[model samples]
Target: MRKLLGIIFLLYGYPAFAQADTTQYRVAGRKNLPENYGRPYVILISADGFRYDYATKYNAVNLLKLSAGGVASKGMIPSYPSNTFPNHYTLVTGMYPSTHGLVDNSFYDPHRDATYNMGNKAMVNDSSWYGGLPLWGLAEKNGLVSASLFWVASESRVAGIPPTYHYKYHNEFSNDRKVEIVKEWLQLPEAERPHLITLYFPEVDSQGHYYGPDARETEAAVHQVDEAIGKLVAEVSKLGLPDVNFVFVSDHGMLLSDVDHPIPVPELVSNRKFVVINSYSLVRIHALNPEQVRPVYRQLKKERNKDYKVYLTRHFPKRLHFRTNADDRIGDILLVPRAPKVFGSNPPSKRKYPGAHGYDPKKVPEMKATFMAWGPAFKPGKVIGTFENIHVYPLVAKILDLPVTHLIDGRSKVLGKTLKSP
Candidate 1:
């Protein structure tokens, strides 16, 4: 247990965030708001890896009370693969990961002849890898201003627009400090205030990864987020900002992963015919040629056991919404491990977490996420059934009256009923 605690501390280095980019990135001379500045303010907050049952199970007092007064869902189903970067981007983009071209946390972009990795700062900030327009992009392009404390791809100029005010990813700032910063943004002048604001918390997700979902460490992380959110609501209320609403969500959830008996990498996977990436939850094999796909897939299927399921690109369930819209980004072959088990071999991350996600949320309900909303814009004391996170995008757009001029996977009708509107 001591070893586990020590590893948790080492894996998460708040001090290292000091060396990272800590400046608030602002677009020069672009503090302008739309002619109709009456649009409601939406603070979209994501607590990474917050499970559907967390608030209730842990008795997160503030969250339970706040959500009770507003709207809460049984669960918010994350897009397939249920990983952090993909689903966070999905929540704001209104598209599935494949549709958005962010197939996984890391994927091979055949067209770019490059790989897009969540850890690769250059790749993450590159606009070309992204397909869908994020909420911030939609707001900015339509003459509204947006800000993000930290969100997946928020720093990137996706669709040629970054949030008017944003900060590059950094963990140095404490939860209380983040809430303070958000309150300050709301206090800005009408022209400079961001109607669409996004805030993210990583502690719960980070702790779940290091200590498993049921550990005391995970509970503490959940409470910490609950406290910060309570503080945010209290502070923001002092400003008397009308039509201010808050949406609290999470990318995905965590499960106690079976790290003791991991699914070993197949031998043929090492062949040059494919570019393989083991992204914890699944193994993506991007074959060099269509011809190379069949032989390897057959071999994998023959060897497949209870540990994992292997599929040709087209064979994946359409309900998953994977491969129905994308093949290149999702790869030629997918090795989806039965949850609790992940793809690994002789050596990868010398140390690994007992908790993992990135599985199909439909199958592993443990991957189901969280969704709650409050403030004047929401119908009070409403409880809704599970819905995909993509629907969140249109819900925000509807709240702010932003036009989503393009066709995307998300349908506001799924969540539109929760609003105090037609």
Candidate 2:
């Protein structure tokens, strides 16, 4: 038992064995922020399910200006399957959905032996279920106050303290109210100011799911949200906080789903071929009653590719690094469709509208989302070739000057390049 415990300790880092003993992890500077006095405040905004083309397609002039004048990726690659809960968690934790244990928007927790849905605050807010520290938690730990507006996992406690300010989950809040609240917080005095602030817009994703990705209503919602964003930016510019930074990014881009079709899960389940845990456009399947796991996995892969493709959990695509650890709660098989369809226990159903995002993050050329950053430390008009969602956490840590031990999935270089060196 001691030997096994030692290995677990080594894998988790010897320091973690100390197990979150204090409110302060470590502080770097006088203000407990990165060395540069001119380091700007960062506002990470998420336009859930907004496609990359929305700027040009919908004429989002304010967003376009930021993209053109500051760093923006051609496409920001998301965690595998590209679901909302996992992707949002990844942005702050710097860990993939697999590593972080949020495999999909919904899944069954074998340990609790119950269904865990992403929208359920009771389930998602439990710190025991979360594997990594979120950006706000890290900031607050190092003496910086942090705030969030309707972000997934924000309700979860960090260092035993809640965000300095936050809103409970509520789908009813209007976009205008969201802007008003963020603007109010930004107006707070510097001493009482939140060093990290996150704002989420759910309309784009909501509309896309009921309609196709390019649905007229979805386009309209994108425009509306952009206008809201414009208002916030205008307000921020007027406040004049020295070196404040603004980062605009999306969890994952949207994809068009058939309004009339859903994939069948019973066919695979009845045959004892696979177990359906949860699904969207992408499905997670565990090998049921494995007689020979590899051979069955191979056959499952072949059968799926006729309409969709499957990757053994251990053999996921290299770029994602999603399936890196066997204990990451990944399924034995992962299924992704080339077309727009979701698999569920019931047969295909029809509605007037349908859209989805759990498709491969790399698929759907237009599925890529946009990112933009502008402020004191970042170079104006500088462009980066590629960026990942996980990079955001490190960037947050760097700007706040919080000391973190883990190297995380992303690099400081991606965000560091934007800053003027000390």
Tell me the alpha-carbon RMSD of every candidate.
2.5, 10.1
Q: Write the per-residue lDDT of candidate 1 for residues 88-122, one digit (tens) a residue.
A: 99999999988988877888877667777776777
TM-score for candidate 1: 0.95
Mind giving the per-residue lDDT tens digits that candidate 2 earns over 234-263? 877887777667788888887776535555
Write down the RMSD of candidate 1 (Cα, Å).
2.5
TM-scores vs. true structure, each candidate: 0.95, 0.84
Clashing pairs in 1: none
**Clash number for every model?**
0, 3
lDDT of 2: 0.68
